[model samples]
Target: MTTDRLTSILNGIGKEISNRQLASILTTGLESFVAEDQAILRTGLAPAPYISASHAHRDGITTQIGGERFSVFRTGRSKSRLNFLSLLRAGHEDYIVNDAALDYMRQRKVAPDVIARLAGHPETSFCSQMAWYDHLVRLRQDVFDPSLVREVSEAAIWGAVRDHGLMGNTVVVSDDAGQFRIPNHALCWVHAERLLQKLMPKTPEQTRKLEAIRDEICASTAI
Candidate 1:
């Protein structure tokens, strides 16, 4: 419940701790602390609330140690299954790559010169650099499949997630095929709703029909 204390503990030895280890440590301590706080409140002892439970999963904490940075993102509720996707939906040229992906890229005929160039360009995002490499490969190779780049990239992600316990339970939620290419994926509802709102009927007749349909939906929901 003590955000400052937790933050201090994490920062103190965060550089030495892996994410999984940190998560385990926090979970055990937080669970016990929350349970004790709840018990104390039931006995009418006024205790200052240290942690806002609701915001715990909605906010992220990032820390820098030894010039290397790590970010911890919390998604509300403990999930056995998870949703994975990119934050942006640009073309193949804007995909991000992880450490595992670097080796995969080398195997996929990405040249050493291209890799070295990308390594020097700190301003360019991992995905963008990856896309650029894909373009280079397409131009250099005679027998080339652009889809193979994505497939290899996705496989790399799947392997990492599986190692981290997501495995088959990870659902890919993205509009872009060049993004995460997991087998089980669904369109994001928020995007779909926004797109639906943008679609307006051109004719009065169509508008009238759509309005009626909306009313019918509302009426059914009310019932």
Candidate 2:
């Protein structure tokens, strides 16, 4: 396919699928290019070796674009599903890597085989440690320690007060000003019901009540 056509297809695929999935499709499409003679190879360089079906479904890969490790969720490998959770956690944003070795060659001047070799290099593995450090630093800067604990507490409290009113206010005091102050009763009742189910013997009446609350919560959060 012409570069413009391929680019258009890829852009469309990116909108519908994860990057890893898109990469896999692109790689498969380029397999013929790789198998051809030098004359044909000159026309279309091989897809990045990293973009393989074999590597499609590995775990511990992050979905973050700049993440050193490739995430199956972001990459759309067989192992990880597209993380809808990420959508809830963070808003939509395009994740792209335009400066990778092969891409550079495609746009600028470079030896094709060299580009192929570079694309296949295990650079991601080498950079993972640095990526992890950067992640930690970002977390430290953005998330307050108390806020983390407070979120946990809040989840718990939400469970606790779903049925019964507040026992006490759940306060999350940050190192800085402006504490996360929540009323005791805003706790998720459904969570508490689940805990109760695990802890206590379930009578038919209790089971029905718990199921009703759980269903209600599930309906409210339906996405």
Candidate 3:
């Protein structure tokens, strides 16, 4: 039997195929490419990244990677939902383009025009933003912001994912800020539930609403 015909019959509308029934059909799908080796799932995060069977990470992949022995299998979920998580090394490590690390160039006896190029121009908003960003990078190392780190990590990850053969059938269904930028993109509704799950609803109405939303998400994402 052809893989496509088998998939067509399994996924046909009004066609309910049980897992055991599909034993003859290979259980593998596009997601298997990554899940087979790198699908280390830890949940309790915003629904955007959550698949169904997820475990929450008390510590985080970041802390685990700190030790001399960084094992991908042992790396767990992050306590903070905003945290950047990945199985790869060198995440936004450079934090910016051009490994050129220059600091406080104004103190030197360089010419005014030379400084003009390095320093941001007031008119150019992009230039100013970069200057501000560079200044922040020069700050202390403990300044780890998950959102910002994810922003950088996403760019690197996107490049690698595209360059490698992870496209076509492989669709990254995530509601995270940047997953849609990938080649094959899709969004998951369950992430909305994650946000509600984290909230401490005050009123009874809010509690009821939260429960309703979660129920809907569970139905959508669950098998």
Candidate 4:
């Protein structure tokens, strides 16, 4: 789909929605798509650019245009009544178009004016909304401070603590390279210990010594 097409769809939806409401919907949709990856960062994984899974969710409406995903949030009693949930559950892969026409078409009916308007309009609003959505998605993917501890240097970690008011207990001092601030609730300390144990030397004597050291650290930080 092109930006023009997306804008037209959004504008069509906008006929029944306020600008603020449209913005809210778009924002909410994007946030739901991106939140999981953001939480993963708090796990101390190296931050990497990833696509939001909004397109995959049952409640999401996604269209792929120009190699990017655009999604919208649709909810309400009317949506369910109109067979939207059924379509979603059945995994129908159609883009949302103008509202009244969509409704009419649902019952195997058509309105010429709706089709005419869609064809005549340049789809400027649709294209612009899509551009904004793409920009927001890319921005979120690029800005990962929490999950990607590998990309974060020691100085950056300190800076985050100071600037972002991040708590200390959530941060993990992994090695000399830097300290990582992982999600306190999500950090798998057992996994980290396993990795640390793997770093031990092959010699049984050295392995035993390293195991003792690992035990001490585990005891100190129960999290």
- Model 3 off-target regions past 4 Å? 1-55, 58-74, 77-85, 88-149, 173-223
| TM-score, per-candidate, Cα-based | 0.27, 0.19, 0.26, 0.22
Error of 3 at 124 (Å): 24
Clash number by candidate, in order: 3, 8, 3, 9
Against the reference, the lDDT scores of all candidates come to: 0.39, 0.33, 0.39, 0.35
RMSD of every candidate to native, in Å, equals: 16.7, 22.7, 17.1, 23.0
Error of 2 at 56 (Å): 9.2
lDDT of 2 by residue, 28-93 (tens): 767455344322321221221111111222444323211112222233332221232221112212
Give one digit per residue, the lDDT tens place, for model 4 in 1-223: 5445556687788655455665566666576545553343322222211111112233443321110122233333332212322222122222223332233233332334433433344431212224423432443433243322112121222222223222334332222111112222222355567677568497999889888978876885663
lDDT (Cα, 0-100) at 52 in candidate 1: 12
Where is model 4 more than 4 Å wrong at Cα? Answer: 1-188, 197-200, 221-223
> Which regions of candidate 1 fall more than 4 Å away from where they truly are?
1-4, 7-150, 156-181, 208-223
Collision pairs in model 1: 93-131, 95-127, 96-127
Which scores greater on TM-score, model 1 or model 2? 1
lDDT of 1 by residue, 52-136 (tens): 1111233442111110121122333332111232211101224434444455456556666645543344433334445645544
Q: What alpha-carbon RMSD in Å does predicted model 3 have with respect to the real structure?
A: 17.1
Q: Model 2, residue 28: what's the lDDT?
A: 76
Q: Write the per-residue lDDT of candidate 3 for residues 1-223, one digit (tens) a residue.
A: 6555665677786667765556655554646654443433211111222221123344554222111121234344552322332322122222222111112122223334533443343321112234535543553212277444344333333333323322324444555443133333444566666677689989999999888878877886664
